[model samples]
Target: MTFAIGIFDLFTYTISGSIYLAFLGYLVVRLHWVDIGALAGTPVPTLIVFVLLSYLLGYVAYPVGAVVNRVVPRRRERHPRQEFLRRVPTAQDRDYVQADPFLLLSALQLHDKDAAAEVTRLRASGLMLRNCAPPLALGFVAAIVELFLSRTPAMAAGCAVLLAVGFFSLIVQARRLSHWARMKTLELCFWLPDIDERYRVDRNAGGGSSPNNE
Candidate 1:
């Protein structure tokens, strides 16, 4: 069942990622990188292949971006730009952020310096992947538009308009993710980890016992 759900999730993301990639295609068309009329002469089957390829590329972007992030040296922000609810976050904020599995186990509970480092690396990688989506989306859109522009101008125009609207929504989602990644990094820095059973029991009844106990 879990495996099936994972498959479903991957398919959903692939299609969604591809749609966003269409935004990239839109930009390319607007920039005249590829003449739309030229695509009109291309065979219908080839155009279909182009559309599929764009989607595949967008889906691939996530892992590629993540890998690139691991290679890149990230600059630490001494302080994140966003204002917190308080100069010192309240217990509620701390609890909320620590609910994240990576922050909780990797940073707080273990307090292993290496774990903290890994968390930071993962966050940086995630940010890069999110940032890559829009540009890739635009690229995909441009290709589709160019391929169909001459043969199906109306269809091409409609796709462009629709994708343009969706692109705005994607931009909002990407920004939100960026903010979350920043706040998570800041939260990791401030939180103190206590893996004691007493503390865990008081905070969360379901919080598991120490691994050594098992």
Candidate 2:
């Protein structure tokens, strides 16, 4: 269970880690600087070069995505609970959503005391361990495959774009987590426990106990 949870947490970074390698492989093909035959001739040095370029390319894509995020205005959202409830009507649905960090945020919003504390614990664990490091290592590993395993230019470009999308999605999730954390902190200052009333209303409306009751 723990290993599965950790992998779920690292999913985005894991998926995106190969962007650098794919981009590097694509560049290698486009520039005509080195071919498979030459790489075989000088395997070790060529691999080292490819590895560095792959990691560097991943870093390069990060700033480009950041800049684009800065330039674009984020859409305003309100009544998040209503939105969440609309989508997650069953305990089964909530269970699946729990894999997402958004589950933590939703718990805070719903005044789930346990979830709030878990968020703080997660925050203290170090971002590199919890967030960035997995992706960095994955990127390096992907670079190896891109350099040695893949050969087609089109496939390389496709992989690069897919990884870029995953990388950008992780960036978006990080921003949402930050925003939700701030909201949770502010709400803490003026804490209110409305769970009893919420439960009462749910029962009166012929609904069963809320999923959070678990």
Candidate 3:
């Protein structure tokens, strides 16, 4: 039962990880710079270069997507449990829309190692072991299964390539999210104003005027 829960938990967090890689691959092809090949036909060199570019792009694209997916939700989620104190929802797994961001922000700033304590504190507090790491492992498992179970050489190769792209993207995104969370810690901690300042001068929906907001 625990293992089954673990598997389900892993899948939920990995949403959007695969799709990002395909998008990244398309971006790589669109930006591929090899002009030596014929405009109409891909030459051996161009094909090789394109493949290399695709591989490299997946490395970057996946990470960027991961950063965007994780951080945006973290920063935006509002707390229903506490009007002033909210939790980060990604790793929480209880209620998505009800999550508060500040609760998460405080947690990350405390637990992480690289002063990334801020980011790590935020990266799905309870779900670190439960959520973040498993999908990466599963992606690898799927890749291996495809490589061995495939019957035809071409199909096997295609699966291998697609699987690689997808998995690679997930990892990149994971790493990038951590990085962005760290950076965001710095940004929110030092640069951004308190929520009151951000919404300055306006009366809140709860009918309270913000201090220094005017």
Candidate 4:
């Protein structure tokens, strides 16, 4: 059961991460490198394959990473739990599975809720906003306008209108990211282990024997 759930949880995490990476690429590539219009002419099947590849990469990246960990050994990791939370390359994340079989699944859901709430908080503060909203909404409206842009048509207007709207979302999302980053930092700080001998227990664990026994 843990194996099945871990696989599924890891896949979801990977896909989300992959999409994040792809979206980052889209922003840079569309802005400076590739012309979206030119790319649109590519064969549909190939495009579909490319998207599937993105999702597939996301789905397997973590599990493959975990499996790799099991298959290899290395210098012992310091702060392995933090490393796991950071989602970097690790030999395995079986530690979490071992700690609590349902932990991975719980983390996924909790992370989502925590992320959304953090974003909303930032939005209220005018720091971060959803970046794609404007462009997407404008594009939708443009499609309608373009059907009649010659009359009331906005064939290309959607893209331009959306560009402006999307900026607002970018601000909100930025704030959200910053807010969440701060929270994550705090959480890590809270969970960080302390090994100072000075802090070790000074009390006897009843090793002297109870007074009654004495």
Candidate 5:
């Protein structure tokens, strides 16, 4: 599971990084900083270099993802714990009300491995979507610049519109996936008898700690 998660992380980073690199490439070409025509002659070497740089750029773009998350704000609705408590009357009596939803989810994972895996997968996908938004936004800006620079303004304008739609869709889907993952976690805990029993016992025994109080 850990290895799989790591691979997913790499895949997400590579995709987002590639888009970011493309954005940079567009800017470079527009500015006449590098002649891509010459680079195209050595296609093999260029592809190899691009692949390597994309992976490296993936790491660099991670902080950009963090900034995107902050700007987008995951908690657009009530916190997951609050939502869970509202939905499940029994949960209101437990430490889950005050406990961080993420921590509580982690604790629930100890008792429900399969459901935990699904939650992990959902969150990973959401993260990828979130990270990709910035690069797409950059690409949209590049397209707008292209509109001004290119002889065919219509083509560039079309590309910009497509990118703009893609950027908006990615943000919307990312938020939905994140919310789904959280709600799924709470739902799984409520439905699974053994997991619910274990979680309730743990919280009642003072195993769960509230983040605010800490």
Candidate 6:
């Protein structure tokens, strides 16, 4: 599962990085920094160079993802844990209110392999969508620039519009996937004997519902 998650992350990075690289490549060609004709003639070597550069840019693109994340409106400004507590009923119990949802979920995963796998899958996909947003935004900008530079303004305009729509949609889907993963974690925790016992103890000690501290 860990390896699978790492591969998914790599794939996300590569995809986003490729877009960033393409944007840079366009600028380089436009500025005459590299000869496009020469690159085309040495296709194999150029492809190898691009492949290596994409992986390197993949690592660099994380900062862009961080910037994009800040620009995007999330459920809460603080940790997602706070949002989970506010939204998830199971997280409202006294025991869970003060507990870290991620930690609890990790503990739950130890005893349930299937639940662990599912959560991992959701998280990986959410991360991919989230990371992709940055490059898509950059692609939109690149397309707009291309509109001014290209002879076919209509095609460039259409590409820009599609990139704009895709960027927005990825942001929405990323948040949804993250929320779904947290909800699934809480739902699965409901069946865990240890979690049940914790709830039982909290109810017995508190004798009522706990107020949301946030």
TM per prediction: 0.36, 0.32, 0.29, 0.27, 0.72, 0.68
Which lDDT values do the candidates have, in the order given? 0.48, 0.45, 0.40, 0.39, 0.72, 0.69
Which lDDT tens digits does candidate 4 get at residues 1-214?
1212232233334344344446555656635776667766789777665656655554444343333323433334234245445664342432231232122223433445554444334333322123223234434454455556445445455555665456445534444454443334333333223311212221223211111100
Error of 3 at 8 (Å): 15
Best-matching candidate per TM-score? 5
The clash tally of candidate 6 reads 0
* Number of the top-ranking candidate, with lDDT as the measure: 5
Candidate order, lDDT descending: 5, 6, 1, 2, 3, 4
Using alpha carbons, what is the TM-score of model 1? 0.36
Count of steric clashes across candidates, in order: 13, 0, 11, 17, 0, 0
Candidate with better lDDT, 1 vs 3: 1
Residue 93, candidate 6: C-alpha displacement in angstroms:
4.1
Look at candidate 1 and tell me the lDDT of residue 148. Answer: 70
Model 1 stretches with alpha carbons more than 4 Å out: 1-82, 85-106, 109-150, 188-214
- Which pairs, if any, clash in model 2? none
- Which sections of candidate 4 miss by over 4 Å? 1-50, 53-151, 154-163, 195-214
| Residue 161 Cα positional deviation in candidate 1, in Å, after optimal superposition | 2.4
- Tens-place lDDT digits, model 1, residues 112-172: 5654554444444444344454554465466465657567776666666665555444444
Instruction: Give the per-residue lDDT of model 6 (tens digit) for 1-214.
Output: 1212255555556666677788788879988899988766676667766766776787777666656766877655334456656776555663544444565566677879778768767766766687778777877888898899989889989999999999878877777777677667666765677665675565678643432211
Tens digits of per-residue lDDT for model 3, 5-113: 2222223333333333434443455457434244558577875555445444434344444443454333233223342123342323232112234433553345443
